[model samples]
Target: MRCRIPETTLREALAAGATYAAIARAHGDDPAAVRARCVALDLSRSRTQGRIPPEPVLRVALAMDGVSVARLARAWGCHPDALSRAARRLGLPTDPVGRAALRGGR
Candidate 1:
Protein backbone atom coordinates (compact mmCIF):
# COMPACT_ATOMS: atom_id res chain seq x y z
CA MET A 1 0.00 0.00 0.00
CA ARG A 2 1.05 3.57 -0.60
CA CYS A 3 1.93 5.97 2.18
CA ARG A 4 -0.40 8.61 3.60
CA ILE A 5 1.17 12.00 2.89
CA PRO A 6 -1.00 14.37 0.92
CA GLU A 7 0.74 14.49 -2.44
CA THR A 8 0.69 18.27 -2.48
CA THR A 9 2.17 18.82 0.95
CA LEU A 10 4.73 16.12 0.48
CA ARG A 11 5.93 18.02 -2.52
CA GLU A 12 5.99 21.30 -0.64
CA ALA A 13 7.87 19.96 2.33
CA LEU A 14 10.31 18.09 0.19
CA ALA A 15 11.07 21.24 -1.74
CA ALA A 16 11.87 22.83 1.59
CA GLY A 17 14.55 20.21 2.36
CA ALA A 18 12.46 18.21 4.73
CA THR A 19 13.51 14.61 5.03
CA TYR A 20 10.96 11.83 4.69
CA ALA A 21 11.01 11.42 8.44
CA ALA A 22 10.53 15.16 8.94
CA ILE A 23 7.76 15.27 6.38
CA ALA A 24 6.06 12.36 8.10
CA ARG A 25 6.40 14.10 11.42
CA ALA A 26 4.90 17.26 9.97
CA HIS A 27 1.93 15.24 8.80
CA GLY A 28 1.66 12.86 11.70
CA ASP A 29 2.59 9.80 9.63
CA ASP A 30 5.05 7.03 10.15
CA PRO A 31 8.40 7.66 8.50
CA ALA A 32 8.09 4.29 6.80
CA ALA A 33 4.81 5.42 5.32
CA VAL A 34 6.47 8.54 3.93
CA ARG A 35 9.23 6.38 2.49
CA ALA A 36 6.66 4.17 0.82
CA ARG A 37 5.17 7.10 -1.07
CA CYS A 38 8.64 8.20 -2.15
CA VAL A 39 9.23 4.68 -3.43
CA ALA A 40 5.92 4.59 -5.25
CA LEU A 41 6.72 7.93 -6.82
CA ASP A 42 10.10 6.53 -7.94
CA LEU A 43 11.62 9.33 -5.92
CA SER A 44 13.47 6.77 -3.90
CA ARG A 45 16.33 4.98 -5.64
CA SER A 46 17.89 2.77 -3.03
CA ARG A 47 16.03 -0.08 -1.44
CA THR A 48 14.37 0.74 1.89
CA GLN A 49 16.95 -0.95 4.05
CA GLY A 50 18.11 2.37 5.52
CA ARG A 51 17.23 6.06 5.73
CA ILE A 52 15.84 7.88 2.77
CA PRO A 53 18.38 10.30 1.30
CA PRO A 54 18.39 13.90 0.09
CA GLU A 55 18.31 12.78 -3.53
CA PRO A 56 14.90 11.14 -3.19
CA VAL A 57 13.75 14.16 -1.24
CA LEU A 58 14.65 16.29 -4.23
CA ARG A 59 12.93 13.88 -6.57
CA VAL A 60 9.69 14.12 -4.69
CA ALA A 61 9.96 17.90 -4.72
CA LEU A 62 10.61 18.05 -8.41
CA ALA A 63 7.68 15.75 -8.97
CA MET A 64 5.32 18.14 -7.24
CA ASP A 65 2.84 20.05 -9.33
CA GLY A 66 4.57 23.41 -9.29
CA VAL A 67 7.92 22.78 -7.68
CA SER A 68 11.13 23.37 -9.60
CA VAL A 69 14.45 21.53 -9.47
CA ALA A 70 16.47 24.72 -9.00
CA ARG A 71 14.33 25.77 -6.08
CA LEU A 72 14.54 22.41 -4.38
CA ALA A 73 18.26 22.16 -4.83
CA ARG A 74 18.76 25.55 -3.26
CA ALA A 75 16.53 24.59 -0.38
CA TRP A 76 18.64 21.48 0.11
CA GLY A 77 21.87 23.46 0.24
CA CYS A 78 23.32 22.28 -3.08
CA HIS A 79 23.80 23.50 -6.60
CA PRO A 80 20.98 22.80 -9.03
CA ASP A 81 23.33 21.04 -11.42
CA ALA A 82 24.66 18.79 -8.69
CA LEU A 83 21.19 17.76 -7.64
CA SER A 84 20.27 17.19 -11.26
CA ARG A 85 23.24 14.90 -11.68
CA ALA A 86 22.40 13.09 -8.47
CA ALA A 87 18.91 12.44 -9.74
CA ARG A 88 20.30 10.98 -12.92
CA ARG A 89 22.90 8.91 -11.09
CA LEU A 90 20.21 7.42 -8.87
CA GLY A 91 18.30 6.33 -11.98
CA LEU A 92 15.51 8.73 -11.20
CA PRO A 93 13.62 10.07 -14.20
CA THR A 94 14.18 13.84 -14.16
CA ASP A 95 10.79 14.93 -15.38
CA PRO A 96 7.76 14.47 -13.18
CA VAL A 97 5.75 13.35 -16.18
CA GLY A 98 8.37 10.78 -17.05
CA ARG A 99 8.32 9.50 -13.51
CA ALA A 100 4.56 9.23 -13.72
CA ALA A 101 4.88 7.34 -16.96
CA LEU A 102 7.11 4.89 -15.15
CA ARG A 103 4.56 4.31 -12.34
CA GLY A 104 1.85 3.25 -14.76
CA GLY A 105 4.17 1.39 -17.10
CA ARG A 106 3.36 3.70 -19.93
Candidate 2:
Protein backbone atom coordinates (compact mmCIF):
# COMPACT_ATOMS: atom_id res chain seq x y z
CA MET A 1 0.00 0.00 0.00
CA ARG A 2 1.02 3.60 -0.66
CA CYS A 3 1.21 6.39 1.89
CA ARG A 4 -1.14 9.34 1.96
CA ILE A 5 1.47 11.70 3.37
CA PRO A 6 1.54 14.85 1.32
CA GLU A 7 4.91 16.27 0.29
CA THR A 8 3.97 19.66 1.72
CA THR A 9 3.08 18.11 5.07
CA LEU A 10 6.32 16.15 5.16
CA ARG A 11 8.36 19.24 4.32
CA GLU A 12 6.49 21.27 6.93
CA ALA A 13 7.04 18.66 9.60
CA LEU A 14 10.77 18.48 8.83
CA ALA A 15 11.02 22.28 8.77
CA ALA A 16 9.37 22.27 12.19
CA GLY A 17 12.30 20.14 13.50
CA ALA A 18 10.60 16.80 13.23
CA THR A 19 13.08 14.19 12.02
CA TYR A 20 12.40 12.44 8.72
CA ALA A 21 12.10 9.19 10.64
CA ALA A 22 9.44 10.69 12.91
CA ILE A 23 7.59 12.23 9.99
CA ALA A 24 7.65 8.90 8.13
CA ARG A 25 6.31 7.09 11.20
CA ALA A 26 3.54 9.62 11.60
CA HIS A 27 2.66 9.36 7.93
CA GLY A 28 3.11 5.61 7.45
CA ASP A 29 5.91 6.01 4.90
CA ASP A 30 9.34 4.46 4.75
CA PRO A 31 11.85 6.28 6.93
CA ALA A 32 14.72 5.55 4.54
CA ALA A 33 12.85 7.08 1.63
CA VAL A 34 11.95 10.15 3.62
CA ARG A 35 15.51 10.46 4.85
CA ALA A 36 16.86 10.20 1.29
CA ARG A 37 14.57 13.02 0.21
CA CYS A 38 15.63 15.12 3.16
CA VAL A 39 19.30 14.51 2.41
CA ALA A 40 18.80 15.55 -1.18
CA LEU A 41 17.14 18.73 0.02
CA ASP A 42 19.97 19.41 2.43
CA LEU A 43 22.58 18.87 -0.30
CA SER A 44 20.76 21.37 -2.46
CA ARG A 45 21.08 23.91 0.34
CA SER A 46 24.70 23.07 1.27
CA ARG A 47 26.10 25.41 -1.39
CA THR A 48 24.48 28.42 0.24
CA GLN A 49 24.26 27.15 3.84
CA GLY A 50 27.95 26.51 4.54
CA ARG A 51 27.10 23.73 6.96
CA ILE A 52 30.11 21.87 8.28
CA PRO A 53 30.03 18.27 9.44
CA PRO A 54 30.81 17.63 13.08
CA GLU A 55 34.10 15.99 13.99
CA PRO A 56 32.46 13.56 16.37
CA VAL A 57 30.12 12.35 13.67
CA LEU A 58 33.09 11.69 11.40
CA ARG A 59 34.73 9.70 14.16
CA VAL A 60 31.57 7.73 14.76
CA ALA A 61 31.27 6.95 11.08
CA LEU A 62 34.85 5.72 10.93
CA ALA A 63 34.47 3.57 14.04
CA MET A 64 31.03 2.20 13.34
CA ASP A 65 31.02 -1.57 13.73
CA GLY A 66 30.10 -3.56 10.64
CA VAL A 67 28.59 -0.41 9.16
CA SER A 68 28.62 0.11 5.41
CA VAL A 69 29.47 3.49 3.89
CA ALA A 70 25.93 3.65 2.53
CA ARG A 71 24.57 3.10 6.03
CA LEU A 72 26.94 5.66 7.51
CA ALA A 73 25.90 8.19 4.90
CA ARG A 74 22.27 7.62 5.82
CA ALA A 75 23.00 8.14 9.51
CA TRP A 76 25.13 11.22 8.93
CA GLY A 77 22.67 12.76 6.47
CA CYS A 78 25.22 12.99 3.65
CA HIS A 79 26.72 11.10 0.74
CA PRO A 80 28.70 7.89 1.12
CA ASP A 81 31.68 9.40 -0.66
CA ALA A 82 31.75 12.24 1.86
CA LEU A 83 31.92 9.79 4.75
CA SER A 84 34.49 7.71 2.89
CA ARG A 85 36.68 10.77 2.41
CA ALA A 86 36.38 11.61 6.08
CA ALA A 87 37.42 8.07 6.96
CA ARG A 88 40.38 8.34 4.64
CA ARG A 89 41.37 11.63 6.27
CA LEU A 90 41.38 9.82 9.61
CA GLY A 91 43.37 6.91 8.12
CA LEU A 92 40.43 4.58 8.63
CA PRO A 93 39.32 2.02 6.06
CA THR A 94 37.25 3.53 3.25
CA ASP A 95 35.79 0.64 1.23
CA PRO A 96 33.97 -1.69 3.57
CA VAL A 97 33.01 -4.23 0.92
CA GLY A 98 36.51 -4.22 -0.52
CA ARG A 99 37.99 -4.97 2.88
CA ALA A 100 35.50 -7.75 3.39
CA ALA A 101 36.36 -9.19 0.01
CA LEU A 102 40.05 -9.03 0.84
CA ARG A 103 39.45 -10.96 4.05
CA GLY A 104 38.22 -13.88 1.96
CA GLY A 105 41.01 -13.55 -0.62
CA ARG A 106 43.36 -16.50 -0.93
Candidate 3:
Protein backbone atom coordinates (compact mmCIF):
# COMPACT_ATOMS: atom_id res chain seq x y z
CA MET A 1 0.00 0.00 0.00
CA ARG A 2 1.01 3.63 -0.48
CA CYS A 3 1.88 5.99 2.37
CA ARG A 4 0.43 9.46 2.72
CA ILE A 5 1.54 11.56 5.64
CA PRO A 6 -0.53 14.67 6.25
CA GLU A 7 1.26 18.00 5.80
CA THR A 8 0.50 19.02 9.37
CA THR A 9 1.92 15.78 10.76
CA LEU A 10 5.12 16.09 8.75
CA ARG A 11 5.53 19.74 9.69
CA GLU A 12 4.95 19.09 13.36
CA ALA A 13 7.39 16.18 13.39
CA LEU A 14 10.08 18.15 11.57
CA ALA A 15 9.63 21.12 13.86
CA ALA A 16 10.07 18.77 16.80
CA GLY A 17 13.46 17.68 15.32
CA ALA A 18 12.38 14.37 13.89
CA THR A 19 14.23 13.41 10.71
CA TYR A 20 12.42 12.63 7.46
CA ALA A 21 13.73 9.07 7.39
CA ALA A 22 12.47 8.54 10.91
CA ILE A 23 9.05 9.77 9.90
CA ALA A 24 9.11 7.70 6.75
CA ARG A 25 9.93 4.57 8.70
CA ALA A 26 7.08 5.34 11.06
CA HIS A 27 4.75 5.53 8.04
CA GLY A 28 5.94 2.04 7.06
CA ASP A 29 8.30 0.81 4.32
CA ASP A 30 7.96 0.82 0.48
CA PRO A 31 8.50 4.55 0.37
CA ALA A 32 9.32 4.35 -3.33
CA ALA A 33 5.86 3.04 -4.09
CA VAL A 34 4.42 6.38 -3.04
CA ARG A 35 7.28 8.46 -4.48
CA ALA A 36 8.32 9.54 -1.02
CA ARG A 37 11.85 10.86 -0.70
CA CYS A 38 13.59 11.33 2.58
CA VAL A 39 16.93 12.57 3.68
CA ALA A 40 19.61 10.00 4.25
CA LEU A 41 19.68 8.46 7.66
CA ASP A 42 22.68 8.69 9.95
CA LEU A 43 22.41 6.14 12.71
CA SER A 44 25.24 7.49 14.80
CA ARG A 45 24.30 9.30 17.99
CA SER A 46 25.04 13.03 18.33
CA ARG A 47 26.49 12.16 21.73
CA THR A 48 27.73 8.87 23.03
CA GLN A 49 25.34 6.79 25.13
CA GLY A 50 26.05 5.31 28.58
CA ARG A 51 27.33 6.66 31.87
CA ILE A 52 30.62 8.19 30.76
CA PRO A 53 32.11 10.28 33.52
CA PRO A 54 32.60 14.00 33.14
CA GLU A 55 35.95 15.34 31.88
CA PRO A 56 37.46 16.12 35.28
CA VAL A 57 36.35 12.82 36.77
CA LEU A 58 37.60 10.92 33.72
CA ARG A 59 40.89 12.80 33.83
CA VAL A 60 41.43 11.86 37.45
CA ALA A 61 40.70 8.23 36.71
CA LEU A 62 42.88 8.20 33.59
CA ALA A 63 45.61 9.98 35.51
CA MET A 64 45.76 7.26 38.13
CA ASP A 65 48.95 5.31 37.63
CA GLY A 66 47.66 1.73 37.73
CA VAL A 67 44.11 1.92 36.38
CA SER A 68 42.97 -0.26 33.47
CA VAL A 69 40.54 0.84 30.77
CA ALA A 70 38.44 -2.24 31.35
CA ARG A 71 38.22 -1.53 35.05
CA LEU A 72 37.32 2.08 34.38
CA ALA A 73 34.68 1.07 31.87
CA ARG A 74 33.19 -1.39 34.35
CA ALA A 75 33.02 1.26 37.05
CA TRP A 76 31.51 3.78 34.65
CA GLY A 77 28.93 1.38 33.12
CA CYS A 78 30.30 1.71 29.57
CA HIS A 79 32.07 -0.58 27.18
CA PRO A 80 35.86 -0.36 27.15
CA ASP A 81 35.85 0.75 23.50
CA ALA A 82 33.26 3.44 24.22
CA LEU A 83 35.32 4.74 27.08
CA SER A 84 38.42 4.64 24.96
CA ARG A 85 36.72 6.49 22.11
CA ALA A 86 35.35 9.13 24.46
CA ALA A 87 38.76 9.58 26.03
CA ARG A 88 40.51 9.78 22.69
CA ARG A 89 37.97 12.31 21.41
CA LEU A 90 38.56 14.43 24.50
CA GLY A 91 42.33 14.31 23.79
CA LEU A 92 42.96 12.17 26.88
CA PRO A 93 44.92 8.94 26.98
CA THR A 94 42.76 5.86 26.92
CA ASP A 95 45.26 3.85 28.96
CA PRO A 96 47.30 4.86 31.97
CA VAL A 97 50.98 5.19 31.19
CA GLY A 98 51.90 2.31 33.51
CA ARG A 99 49.30 0.00 31.99
CA ALA A 100 50.34 0.93 28.45
CA ALA A 101 53.91 0.14 29.25
CA LEU A 102 52.81 -3.17 30.77
CA ARG A 103 50.92 -3.94 27.58
CA GLY A 104 54.03 -3.03 25.55
CA GLY A 105 52.39 -0.16 23.64
CA ARG A 106 52.26 3.62 24.03
Model 3: lowest-lDDT 10 consecutive positions: 38-47
Top lDDT prediction, candidate number: 1
For candidate 1, the TM-score is 0.40
- After superposition, candidate 1 runs with Cα above 4 Å error: 1-55, 99-106
Off by over 4 Å in 3: 1-49, 96-106
In terms of lDDT, the poorest run of 10 residues in model 2 is 43-52
lDDT of model 3, residue 49: 40
What tens digits encode model 2's per-residue C-alpha lDDT throughout 3-27? 4566677668866768667887887
Clash pairs of candidate 3?
Answer: none
Each prediction's whole-model lDDT (CA): 0.67, 0.60, 0.64
lDDT (10s digit) by residue, model 1, range 13-78? 766767888887777788888988877776653322232346657556656666676666666666
TM-score for each of the candidates: 0.40, 0.37, 0.44
